[model samples]
Target: MKTNVKTSPILHLTYAAVCLALCMVLPFLTGQIPQVGSALCPMHIPVLLAGFLCGPWWALAVGAVAPLLRFALFGMPPLFPTGAAMCFELAAYGLVSGILYRKLPKKVLNVYVALIAAMLAGRVIWGIVMVVLMGLNGSAFTWAAFMAGAFVNAVPGIIVHIILIPIIVLALRKAGLAD
Candidate 1:
């Protein structure tokens, strides 16, 4: 028997809203941790979720807007450099994830492969944005800093995402909340 499961746009929108709000709250949890605060924000979760559920564009939209909105509303990001940097990075993540997932053949490999690719690509974009637009001032941009800022600092959040997001997606799929 074929099941007539349908995914709702409103539900996806609600998911985006909640994820954006969660991103807003993340700053509070690490606001005083020097560079660590912005580096490890859980905002990426919603963006990825949107991509996995809706499509690349929706994910990109959520990723691009969430940080800026949070900054505007709650002063989380505080200024231009980090905020602008994140726009590109987050957008890359969404775009890469969606693209990779669609192109890959295996469902088991899809999320992990896409996620790793997205993470790498997003960080490359983030590093480029920081160096080109934000600049390191007198300091040079190195692999260590890139890895530290782009990857290491985000390790926990990355772990959280890898562990939780697929399960969430699967649950949503099972409950007829996702495609």
Candidate 2:
């Protein structure tokens, strides 16, 4: 008899917890290097990966909670706007990636497509969050600023995600760890 390789609640929760932990720890480790932490966006890797590994809801939970949890534990990302924006951004990333990955054909190219779409959606959500938060505070955030942060500053992280995520996912599939 063969067992079906389906994701159970326990597995989902376990993976979400692990991903959340990684999200918190990656930032802390990268934060030691000046400018690299914000630029490279270490926190995003695991959240996106969780989207691929787990389903949307589990990934969303990890994404939504990680920033605040990190702030509470480490006091790195201040609670007000940055953490809040990050929450929305990462939540979008996880949700979109998972939805696309789950719905699309099980092919390597689909992974890249989903990842790219998720990245764009996350950035858009981040920009929207920043606009509202900044506007309410009498501060200004321009589209140009959003573009710079989302694309220019995050080029390295984007490249890393493009190269690393698919490779990891494919490896997991090959190893029979992922479907």
Candidate 3:
């Protein structure tokens, strides 16, 4: 039997707030080991989750603001380039993920598809932003650098997201919260 499932703006706002909170806190937990910090990508999890819990617009808002807000609060990530570029990258992640998930059929495979597509799109946006930022700074962003930043170095985070997101989404659905 199909029953109506409705989520209000208040709920979405609540979810986005929780996600933003996590974005602030998760990095502290993961940043202890500098070697694994980038690989683990603790800041990304909540934005991605917001994409699913809220819609693209809310997710985009969260993504675009999270880095800048964090920088404001903690002064890490350095506002000039890193945080600016991340504004676009994380927004793309949340926007693309939410859009794809809503448009595609709700299946386990589709979850993976949306997640992978979002990751790729976000990386691509990050590269483009980096290129522009680097150009403005009178530097070159080479293909090798792009490759290393986008794919090669991100392998660990990619693997973790692939394994984790679907499980969480599926579990939420099972509990009827994600209906």
Candidate 4:
């Protein structure tokens, strides 16, 4: 008998749950330095991995819920803008990564392609959410702010993800845990 990750709902649900839990915990590591904390983007890794291990819908659900749930329990990110913006951003990361990974060939290059695309899409979604949320609060989300938040401040996390995610996914694939 053989197991396929894509066809295993229980396995996906378990993985998504684990990813959601990681979202709540990982931020604590970077929270020590408020300056570099957000830049590290601790919550992103598990969410992106969830997309690869689970499928898009499960990953999206995990991504969307993780922030709000974390804020509800931890009160770290605050519920208004940061948490709300993250809801969309992480959702995009998981959705885009899962979708692309599923659609593209299961090769190393395709993993990078999907991961990069998901990161870009997630950042864009984050910027959009910031614009809408800030506008609702009667503030402007300037292009400079968007650039800083979406790319400049995020460089560390981006590099970390680029380095870490594919390795983990590929390792999981080698271990027969991921498709």
lDDT (0-100) at residue 95 of candidate 1? 80
For residues 108-172, write the lDDT of model 3, one tens digit per residue. Answer: 89888988899899999999999999999999999999999888988888888888888988898
Root-mean-square deviation per candidate: 3.7, 1.6, 2.4, 1.6
For each candidate, what TM-score against the reference?
A: 0.80, 0.94, 0.94, 0.95
CA lDDT of each prediction against the hidden true structure: 0.74, 0.89, 0.87, 0.92
Q: Where is model 3 poorest over a 10-residue stretch in terms of lDDT?
A: 1-10
Error of 1 at 179 (Å): 1.5
The segments of candidate 3 whose C-alpha lies over 4 angstroms from its true place after superposition are 1-5
Residue 32's lDDT within candidate 1 is 67
Give the Å shift of residue 26 in candidate 3. Answer: 0.7
Clashing pairs in 4: none
lDDT string for model 2 (34-56, tens) is: 87667888889999999998989
Q: Of models 3 and 4, which has the larger lDDT?
A: 4
